[model samples]
Target: MHDEIARLARHVAPRRATRVASAGELAQPVLVVGSTLPVGQLEVIFRRPEVGSVAVQDDAAPTRTGIVTRAGLAAALTGRLGYGRAVLERRPTGAVADWSPLVVEQGTALADVAALAMARTAERRYDDVLVSGPAAWGAASTADVMRAVVAELAERSTHDPLTLLPGRSATWYALRHRCSLVRGGATRVVLVLLDVRDMSRLNAEHGQDAGDAVLAELAARIGAALPAGCEVGRVEGDGFAVLATLPAMDDIQAAASADALRQHVLAHLAAPSDGFDPAAWPALHSAAAWSVAGAADADELVAQAERRLRRERRAAVLV
Candidate 1:
């Protein structure tokens, strides 16, 4: 009995020592990754502000994780996932002594980030853990998690989350597999990628939630603007990758569809929303479209579209 009591006391003493050593490191912007600890002590150790963000793992079959901050945790539960807010927490005071504080860069959307955090939590079996990232623009969020899931689905089907147009993988695969059929005649492939401007600011200022809303809205508008017999899926975050063949690939016809797609997107953004405030709209947002013919396959075509979009973003920055 005496030996056990002394051993326990000795174990606890080291934890206190580690905490003391961690004080300076904890003062900076940070992510607190650990499984077990009370929120109150966590706040004190990390000095997180009142109304800060946090998540607690949810106890679902997959294991839903939770952030510990009052506002962030509650917001996530209420479906208002916040993004770009720095995370802070304490290192555990006892063994398994491999645990350390965590910190990561901010992501693009709150919705995406919350989704990722939940994903990580769901994947983890242990209860004594927290996952965190930066609270800056382009940081991860629940919506990002959704986008990732959606993208994965797009790989299987025809949908793309970015532009709500046919994704590169699905589109190219379909073109290669179906375009060669004699019933369809010799196919001409026309691929287009629409590039948007300064999207990072949108995620940073309006918050990831707002940014995701814009992406979703943009994708829907693009999907609706396609020409007859055309299919759309989102392939990337700020670009729409498209593939069509032969007669439809004519310069005039393809240009018209691309123009119509761009105009529709602009009109939608200009249109009033019931809940969106125009006064706080993002400062910069523009679109560019790319077209290509005779692609070997979907993967190659998508790579081409990605290159086009990257070039447009760079040009926009210069402009």
Candidate 2:
């Protein structure tokens, strides 16, 4: 007895793992068994409460396997079949399993699984989606899949159409989300607004296609050249916003960081990749204005930045 106790303590026993995969994030262990089990026995098996569904391997039509849900089994025996347990009690459990349950491979995308689940007939529309693996089976709830799909759609909506950068709504949302965290330090928020010199005239002089290429190229320059952690967004036509949260502790450091970022963006605009010829595109130039704020005053910060940009444009005209 002592030897058995010591050996058991030394070697940890294995336990069933609850695993989550890309196919469905919320995964649950599903009991998989052969078809010969009595239908009435499932009532006792399901009483433990952890098992949401069961995969019964059998020679059922439409698919070789089926999922028997607790609710499904109950309804099948007591409601669907006329004689209730009297008729189904002696039958194999496979006879009552959902033969047309949606089956997906282990790595299938959540959105696709959700779509497939909803596409099923009304009778089986909310059935558990079975994740088939090389050696095991798993299941996911239809509600979880739908929630994932909704989140994916919400995020996709925030992308700008042309540059594919975060659009105005996303930019505002990020600023608001991070506002509280950046309480008061040196000016921690850097908002740079850039617009082409003469967007309308440029399009007229060249073509709409050239204007688009310029915006896309400009977005690439800022998105690629900025230091990591900075968020770049194309908030409006011919205008881009770069929101940066700096670690500067003083005005001097904040000023230095902002100027450095401005220079970095301008330098990248002048320079192109080795394979690309700059002469192929129009001499891409933009007017830029910057605003730095230490508080969570996004509105005031943006207004000051726009005012500065206007003054700079007027100065350029005078020159």
Candidate 3:
């Protein structure tokens, strides 16, 4: 059983919440100035604490723009006095601006922003992401962009790759959520664990493709067999689970429901489909359990169900 269930069950919001679907959500209003702004004047503007970054519009090409951070401006002006403060400070801001800025549309997703930001050369990798919008230009700092990336990755970690199902962390979280619902709601939640006994043997006898196809096919079949208010996720490579709420049932009724569902799943898998061959398949076992009005936490219920699935009554050992 996964030890991280308790940790995952707590819903900890990301620094930048997972809801940040686009770069626009991370944007901060920035100062926009004409390209012709004097370098010395730009430096003076940086002195004002309100200005985090400045967007410079190209005078020759109005639609084209560049960005300058206070640090970037300092880097430009701190050079040994070549032309003197008098001559050099007056050069157009564009000369010192990052002409190749990481510009993104306001609607661009944070994942895309992170990709563009990281793909940049090391010098520009930490540059702010410029948001080009209809009304105004905004900036998303590289740090914030990275935070958004972190949140995005965290959200993804809870999901399975091939089945696109909520993975281990997410499964535990949902289990808790459903347990709460069942306590006050008009139903009871049951967890069903199905193990494919021949997974490793299938892979060795056929190939990885066949093994994968079987898991995917079983997931689909189990999902289709379940009632309207149920969810199925891939917890282990060869194991799939279903969390379903049925009309209040006694322990006897619950076990019967579980058996009926299990048999339906096995019957479906016994036949060959586009995903696998019947000849390559072998014994399958399943165990089902539920809490009485949320008496058990998700981890305990899952551990209980997994323990039952270990012997032949459920299926051959996971190998």
Best by TM-score: 2
Each model's C-alpha lDDT? 0.42, 0.68, 0.74
Whole-structure CA lDDT of model 3:
0.74
lDDT of 1 by residue, 181-219 (tens): 313332344455554456677677788788777766666
Higher-ranked by TM-score: 2 or 3: 2
| Model 1 lDDT-worst window of ten | 8-17
> Per-residue CA lDDT of candidate 2, range 1-319, in tens?
2221122111121222333336645666688876878987877788887888899888444348888987798787776546788888888887888777898987788877877888888878888889887777889888777776776666568777678788998787765555545656443666667666678877887778877877888888787876656677887788887776655446665556655665566677676555444543433233333334557567765776678778867876787
Model 3 bad stretches (over 4 Å):
1-64, 67-100, 104-144, 160-164, 180-186, 220-229, 249-253, 260-283, 297-300, 307-319
Residues 133-196 of candidate 3 have per-residue lDDT tens digits of 8999999898888887787677678767677667876777778877776665435567888877
Q: Which is the leading candidate under lDDT?
A: 3
Span of 10 residues, lowest total lDDT, candidate 3: 1-10
